[model samples]
Target: MSHQSGHQHHIWVQSHHPVKLEPKLPQPLPKEPTFYYFAYGSCMCPVDLKRSLGENTHHYVIGPSILQGYRLGFYVYSPTRKCGVLDIVPDPKASVKGVLYQLPWRLSEYLDKREGVAQGLYRHELVNIHCQDQVYQDVRTYIVVDKLAEEAAPNDWYFNVVLRGAVTCGLPEEYCWHLFNHMYNLQQRNQERQLRESA
Candidate 1:
């Protein structure tokens, strides 16, 4: 698929290749701490993820998760309490595929901060979000709460980052098309609702 600059953006996350910390954090144990990052709304592109996980992060591009009936919602940009997660009903038949990254202990710390993993905003959980016979083993991932961003819909520029990254992650053409269609519809609905609430 050709790269286009619009609703869907294309960001390249560089690999700085930083050294991993030998001594992990005392509280967040890494004894069997495996990193499993879910990339549904964004975080799909390896390069972008690489920036967060560094070059040594191991990942499996498994996705199309049901989100367990949870929908993708936007919070205030990032590093904000306004961030929220949303509800999207799950269809056992329909799969929302994305990427899953498994990083080392040191890398996880960096992501923890980036994703607000410490403030109890994003909780780490293990899930089996895959199609066919594929299943992730002991994959730990963090999830954001939808209600936080319920009122703060992401702006076009921020959402574009997700769109662009998803495109580069090798999402199937059909799925990519669906994303475009869904994003448009969601944008319109969000606007109308905002107007009504204000009125």
Candidate 2:
């Protein structure tokens, strides 16, 4: 990894209509959830998984230190708040030097809500992440926005949190500056759109 080096495997959430969001995706029974949840956001703040699963939680955060090349975006929208937090998927090429929350076979309502699995915006799936000098395979978690939608734009608040976390997580400045640069570009684009729309 060159810069970014970390990723957001955690999420933002709301209500879910699984059938609507996942027309073809297979649904996994929560009862059989023996996989780990790779947390990259607030869950990364601590081993919240341990709280949710008691002694069942395993592994602290390990990483390829997912560096640059991923874009953090939002899935669920909060109409009343006008701005939602970061919860989108990271680019596959981008790395998420994220914490792995190994969860036991029980439903964590807090995580389910946080990732919006209950909400239609995301559907749970198993994906492998590179971490701890080896390849981690078949871990399960929810991915928001089935296929990233094309927008000529992106979100401001969402990007800030990711950049802040990555930096706080100890990612270097050149890499951090790269994120800020991306933010600057998005801000410019939003301003341009607003100017045009107002006109």
Question: Please, what is the whole-model Cα lDDT of each candidate in the order they appear?
Answer: 0.54, 0.51
Q: Give the TM-score of candidate 1.
A: 0.59
Listed in order, each prediction's TM-score against the native is: 0.59, 0.55
lDDT of 2 by residue, 56-120 (tens): 33333343243233445443454422444334465757554445545545546656655556556
Worst 10 residues of 2 by lDDT: 6-15
**Model 1: per-residue Cα lDDT at residue 152:** 48
- Writing each residue's lDDT as its tens digit, candidate 1 over 1-199 gives 3546432442322123212433543544345555556666546656556666667333445444333434444433354423222222334545555656555556678777756666655656566655445666555555654434243455564456566766766667776777666666667777999899999
- Scored against the true structure, residue 65 in model 2 reaches a CA lDDT of 42
The residue-level lDDT of candidate 1 at 151 comes to 36
**Root-mean-square deviation (CA) per prediction:** 13.3, 16.7
Shift in Å, residue 182, candidate 2: 2.9
